[model samples]
Target: MAKVNISLDAELVVEVMVLAGVGSPQDAVEAVVRDYIARGHRTEARTELTEQSLREVEATPQEPQG
Candidate 1:
């Protein structure tokens, strides 16, 4: 993987390190980013629409009838 360098506040990096329980700041930040990506994938899986669901929705009446 390609590496990029970015600057962050010392206090923020220390906070992330403590929260992630990792001694290295790089490891802590990487852990947080990976966790964030995994969470997004899980959320997408939960909310994803399927072909069967689309068919079911299409079968339902779209308007009210008196």
Candidate 2:
């Protein structure tokens, strides 16, 4: 795997480590990034339009007003 080094605030890194329950700052940041990506994928899956869904919507009958 390729690695890149970036600068971050010491306090921010410590906070991330504490929140993520990770022993190292790198692991904490990596975990957070992975979680963010997974969340994006989940959101995309939920909002994606499908051919079946479109057909179902089109087949629904409208009710007449009382």
Candidate 3:
């Protein structure tokens, strides 16, 4: 296993530990690694950014409704 040194917010770490039923920070980190490797995360970011730009171009100024 590749060893990585990273930091997590204390609250978030606790939350993930409780939900995941993991015993230690390493376990939580490993879970994240497994999930991240299995599911690539970047494609959606690009897609969302593209959609937002398109919406900005297409959005028309709306008249305030009474």
What are the lDDT figures for the candidates, one per model? 0.91, 0.90, 0.82
Model 1 whole-model lDDT (C-alpha atoms): 0.91
Query: Which regions of candidate 2 deviate over 4 angstroms?
Result: 49-55, 59-66
Q: What ranges in model 3 sit over 4 Å off?
A: 41-66
- Candidates ranked by TM-score, best first? 1, 2, 3
What would the per-residue lDDT of candidate 2 be over residues 1-66, giving only the tens digit for each residue? 999899999999999999999999899999999999999998777667565687789899978989
lDDT of 3 by residue, 7-64 (tens): 8899988888887889797798689778887566576777889999999977977789
Our tally of clashes for model 1 stands at 0
- Please name the candidate that would achieve the greatest lDDT relative to the true structure: 1
TM-score winner among the candidates? Answer: 1
**How far is 9's C-alpha from truth in model 1 (Å)?**
0.5
lDDT by residue for model 1 over 1-66, one digit each (tens)? 999899999999999999889999999999999999999998787667565688899999889868
Candidate 2 local lDDT, residue 32:
93
Q: Least accurate stretch of 10 residues (summed lDDT) in model 3?
A: 37-46
* Candidate 1: segments with Cα more than 4 A from true spot: 49-66
RMSD (CA, angstroms), candidate 3: 7.5
